[model samples]
Target: MTAERGVHKPNLLVLVGPTAVGKTRLSIEIAKSCSCEIISGDSMQVYRGMDIGTAKITPEEMQGIPHHLIDVLDPEESFSVAYFQKVCRSLIPEIASRGRIPFIVGGTGLYVESVCYEFQFTEAGADEAFRQEQLRFSEQFGPEALHAKLTEIDPETAAKLHPNDQRRIIRALEVYHLTGTTLSRQLESQTKASPYNLCIIGLTMDRQLLYNRIEARIDEMVQQGLVQEVKSLLERGCSRSLVSMQGLGYKEIAEHLLDGLPLEDAIMKLKRDTRRFAKRQLSWFRHMKDIHWIDVTRGENFPDHLADIRAIIAGKFGIPLEYNYKH
Candidate 1:
């Protein structure tokens, strides 16, 4: 809705876009202009050893802007939307207290949505045995087979999830097995009222151009030693089944490093998976309400786009932004 509803509510500024759509550079610029601290909304960036593949921001890239919820967990530890919500909700007000806007920036649609709307996850009991069983089923029959199981139980949620998203697909299945109700049903029942006054910005570009960027980024990662990154994690005894390993870049490369998937094939799969992931991300964000969408298809015009975004933020939040406009 609005960036600031009243003095009673704190403001939250969120920037969401599919992978390789250029959120990182623009986010830093926006943060600098708005005096904001960024909280990474991505699930994978939380893991410490997953730098190159996750596109984790370097200290130099942050450019003195504070970033939270990144590199905070070991690759072996699990991160859930609940944890994201808890940490982000805590940080939002803390950042606001310091007179800085709490800016959430990344492409993890569900995780960002959960914090924005305060999604109350159902306390559906977990069945470890059932979870383990499903995991085994996925490994044996492939992730598509496991995704098919969820489709039979809850087609709505299954449609949003990628077949390669085994972590979420299995959780949806587990929720159904435990509660006898669809995860989609539970989500539909949750309140959409947000506690913070929100300004949500979504970035998009031409689909073909985005795919080209995704492929090029993957190629860059290979040159940056993506296989070695995965190899290091595996050498540290991180399981391939770990949620961190299931992320787009890590999963495909790990297959190459461990199970002898050819490097070429692995890179190809990673590129394809990332493209699909970006599509799914767009689909997810489309359902969210009140996002101001900006098209950044022309990479050379980023300065103009950045000025436009700053205007949007200034108008929404009623804040003064410091920037020099060139004619």
Candidate 2:
């Protein structure tokens, strides 16, 4: 693609990476430089009381820049990509109207991509009869049976989705009944075109280094009372199966706490799962062909990396990225 194709779009500085890769710090710098507001892309970070486990940034870390969409959702309330799209859509334009960039930053690939691609969503009215039929099918025939049925109807989507990914499976069947369009077709329609001009910035490090950082971050979280955070959520009556609990560290700790696994064992599992999660995140972003990759391996030279980032944004997205003479 021509430089103009990369350079002329309005700036939505999306800084994403695997967990604990320092996306937060870099994002603060980027947001400050571009006179931008940061919108979160982390799915778990939206929960109101789940701060420690979510590794949420404190007020001090924010460095006085405005942030949106963090700590807004109740843990018990269901959050979907559609909801996130609505929030981002509402915020990005508002930021733009003020002549500031909207920097979408975090580690959640699906949440980030859904907004960046402007994936169209179809409004499907439920057919109660058909919905009841599928619920009965799942009850008597089991989730696998329901998954098999979805496979017959939408093989492509099923190929990537897990058989136990019941929520997505049920959604697929729901769409099939409600709109008479297969889940695959709805996704196809959602791909019609994206609304915003987005600049994707992917952060990276050596695999071993990233994994080490993730484990270290987990250790830090444990010290910072992540277990207490999860315990508090349980007190709030969120079940283990809830989406919030499915988050990497929370799930393992919950299992250990409730099921008799030693705390060390739980922490070990948490660390391992996080590494696996980082791997999956890398796999997910592998096909994101438009991202500009930034590999920050050296510990020092923050300013050098920041400058390189600013130049890339200015050259690629027509934004005048500011930088401190010393900082």
Best by TM-score: 1
What tens digits encode model 2's per-residue C-alpha lDDT throughout 1-327? 434554444457788888888888888888877888999998888989888888999999999999998889888876777889899988988998898888998877777888888877777754657756766787688878988998998997776555545555776888877777886777666663456666778888899999999989999999999889888888879886566776767877787778888999999988886787787677777767578888887758778888888888887676455576355
Clashes of each: 0, 1
What TM-score would you give candidate 2 relative to the actual structure? 0.83
Please report how far candidate 2 places residue 8 from its true position, in Å.
10
Cα distance off (Å), candidate 2, residue 247:
1.6
Q: Show model 2 residue runs off by greater than 4 Å.
A: 1-10, 124-189
Instruction: Output the TM-score of candidate 1.
Output: 0.96
| Regions of model 1 farther than 4 Å from truth | 1-4, 324-327
Question: lDDT tens digits, residues 1-327, model 1?
Answer: 343374667889999999999999999988887899999999999999799999889999999999999999988888988889999878998998898999999899889999999999877867879989998998799989999999988999999998988889988998889888898998899789988878899999999999999999999999998989989989999988788988888889888888899999999988988999999999999999989999999998999898888888888777778885443
Measured over all alpha carbons after superposition, the RMSD of each candidate to the real structure, in angstroms, is: 1.7, 4.0
**Model 2 Cα RMSD, 1 decimal:** 4.0
**Among all candidates shown, the one with the greatest lDDT:** 1
